[model samples]
Target chain A: MKPDSPFLDLETAPRVAVSIDGAPLELPEGANLAAALLAAGVTVFRHTPVSGAPRGPFCMMGACFDCLVDIDGFTRQACMIEVSQGLRIIRPRDLGADDVDA
Target chain B: MSTHDLIVIGAGPAGMATASKAADLGLTVAVLDEQPRAGGQVYRDVDRVAALRGDILGADYTQGATLTAGLHHQAIEHVPGATVWAIEDGFRVSYTRAGRGAQIAADRILLATGALERPMPLPGWTLPGVMTAGAGQILLKQSGVLAKSAALVGCGPLLYLIAAQMVRAGTPPVAMIETQTRSDLIEAARHVGGALRGWPYMLKGLKMLAEITRAKVPRYPGATEIRIEGTDTAEAVSFVHRGRAHRIACRTVFLHHGVVPNTQAARSLGVSHRWHAGQSCFAPRLDVWGQSDVTGVFIAGDGAGIGGAKAAELAGRLAALKVAEESGRLSTDERDRQAAPLRSAHARELAARPFLDRAYPPFAGALAPEDATVICRCEEVTAGDIRGHARLGCLGPNQAKAFSRAGMGPCQGRYCGLTVTSLLAAANGTSHDETGYYRIRPPLKPVTLGELATLEHSAPDTAE
Candidate 1:
């Protein structure tokens, strides 16, 4: 871990490599996916399907949908997911197959 | 189908307490929570993160261990990682759990879905690095994460608590840009005597402020015209403080304007809710026993209203006591006897609410921000668009939903319902109650089609 890591007393766990937006990064296994992504300097979680504006996890408690990311072909809340090995994540251009912005 | 005498949704303070108490009264209970752990947001992952979070988050968080521990009773089945999407007429709850779907039957239902942090819908809030105070707290609680030198903006008691927690974590915020004006404080003075009766709550706030002050964190009180100035990401926070334009150079901005009941599940249950002007949210209309207008349904904790965790615990137990009586295990007289102390204690906790609500009222600007600020995080609907809908005769939330798709996002208006209501009310020259809230439908949480196919019987009762 970097000495200037954003986490406090971030204990060493079995780190697993995950591909976020086609970039390989290591995250602490079983940690929050959203927080892990943020710690790894991946800030923009997704782009709004409407305007394509960049957005990240805002509520982290699953209330806001800002952290919606495609996890290995499925869309889910990153905040609600625990980090596991080899999870492929991406920001979906379309919120769903049939998408409309309010 | 798994059947229980009672089905409780959420594993927060309210749900856990209700399940444990009802089970002890000999009614089989099951608690379905979305998280893998039992502790709701307040005590989230307390068991795993205890050593890292206890000292920083303080005893209030550590206390969640006791509440979660109560879920261990044999009569109480705690189902963690369950996302309940629909509740049918026969007290049937359909939820997605562990990559599959399941249905449970119960004679009684309790919802303790807790509360959502009021969305701080200011300009650039949708930008990267701008998140809620609760969100930052969750990162710290769940994973010992902290964004360095972040600035917290908005008005609320939780902001101070979060700031103090960050200070204790050795990552104190760079500044606090509070939006509560002097007049707001003066307006709250009338409730001083009432709030003083709840001195412990008041004292805790003062102590937190002292902690932040000791750390020498710069605070801008009564700030106005606040804006997050960034093109693609949150680079800095600019606001008018003390009648002068000021900008704080910071990478991360945590915005909060207090909390409101997470009413999505309860509203989806088809219960009638009344608009609360003080909190500026809609709370379910429940009787003294926490029974909603719907006969077999009950609400407790913040889902019932915005009582803090302690009060939520007491209210949960009170609701459980009534449920116990209705389930035929306990008598009405016994229920009343047991509820006596809890009721008084619960009343004491809420006594401090009026002053706090008025003093640190939701930032007027953030609640109805500039035309450009995004109100609906999921749909990216701006305030100006919602106001325009009102100008085009969008009289209520449901109408605004049709006109602008303001509440149709997957999160389903949980973040934008209040703002949409407020904007329509303001534009149409009506009160919030008159403007009304979105008539929430089922599938409260998004359920995947893969999960839905696993259901053995009919389709979801929700209208497409």
Candidate 2:
């Protein structure tokens, strides 16, 4: 991607291609799910139901729960969740009404 | 079934005074504090160590025992080491005690939770031996342990108090760097004239100044930079005042720019906050009676603003009186009389805070630690990481967190979120609060993995 921009030193940390939201994406070693998503410019982490307002990371820890997104098949704090190759991120609405966890 | 008509969330001057007044009205009042004893931070047992060596830190802390004992006699259940996590709707409080979760319900809630020392960042602040002045004082008072030799810095009344306390302890400070200028010291004398009715306090301030003068601790006013140097532990600190460099060869550094309202829990509850330009932090917006916009929830003491202990106590009693009026327990005349002292004290505190804040606004360099310094100790992310992400056009804290994992930690960014956000704002040349902290959500404390597993899975068709 643009000859690595001379920014990310992939030699220090290996590069890995991880699937997010079922889409293949390449990330570096030791990169967290939240950071990888942000580096790729996927800022809108989730959306609220009633008003359908877009929401993203706040507090960036498991404390806020603002960065919660459905990964693989379960809803979890994206800040706490780390990135791995071939992982899936599902949207809240896509999880269906009955399967939601509050 | 131990129930109370009202539950106050601190036993400091504010909580004690409020409980006293509330108990006088025949309401069962319960006070909870994280400390094993009352008196909060201000009246902590600092001087008792002096008594061990036969010196007078003063009688103010000792006199507080009467107020605490009086509350105890009023049938008030003072639960110590009770960390309140959240105040739910209908006044249900979920808290942790002795490492177990517990719940209690109350008719009315007063948060007199007092203030926490504002986090002032400097190079090597994350080092082991460098601590907030509050932490050092607490250690000395609570455990009879000193911080070995120390270099105390920052500008505030507490600096003078701690300096005096250190002198009395027979181990005077190696160096004391003041951020306030000689002009501010002169202004303090002038400001105390109108507040001379509290002559005892004015005299105390004078006596402290005299001690500083006599000790010749080399007061450096308008201190700009504080450089704490060490690896894994603090070895020494260096600062610049005027145009000269002053360094202290000491093992410990006690620092506090000023106090700020502890609004972490309050803000997470969606209780709106007003940015107090004076304190440079957002404090809970409260009316004269300390009633927040959230109905049935009241804030008092330093939570409303950084008034000292005296004003905090007055605010607590006044808030209770206001609550008494709203609950039909007091008439308008009674309410006015009860709140008179608080109104006056609040005015005085407000008048003094602006001058105090401006006199020592975080010495530009103290705004954020160097880019190489670790901003988030939990994730071990440095300021460089945050800056790198910012260069890639990451707009906000959330975006930066995604790129650097700076705010992701067990402490949950409570310690680092504000710092990282401030750094982001500065690097991007934006407003400070514009790069506001990460949003707070539910499960305020770290819930166990077993507990999460225990929560029943949502049904497939359920709406919530």
- Per-residue lDDT for B1-464 in model 2, tens only? 24577889877788888888887766778887755457676665332333442243456556666567667655588887565666676676666654455666687888887776665667776554566677555544433334447788787777888788777666677788877776765655655544455555556777997987788777777877678787535678888888888777876678777777766666666778755665676688787788888887788888788878777777877877877787787898988986776688766655555445555565456556677776675566777788888899987888887887766664566656666767788789987567666765555555544443433333332225
Identify the candidate with maximal TM-score.
1
Question: Tens-digit lDDT track for model 1 on B1-464?
Answer: 78899999999999999999998899999899999998999999998888766889998899899998899999998899898889887798988887799888899999999999887788878888898999989988888888796999998898999999999988999899999989998999999987898899999999999999999999999998888877767889999987899989887899998899998888887898898888878899999879999999999999888989999999999999999898789998999999999999999999999999999999889777799888988778899999888878889999889888888999899889999988988899998888889998888888888998777764355425
Interface RMS for model 1 = 1.8
Model 2, TM vs. native? 0.73
Best candidate according to lDDT:
1
Q: State the weakest 10-residue window (summed lDDT) of model 2 chain B.
A: B454-463
Q: Model 2, residue B343: displacement in angstroms?
A: 2.1
* lDDT of model number 2: 0.66
DockQ of each: 0.63, 0.02
lDDT of 2 at A82: 50
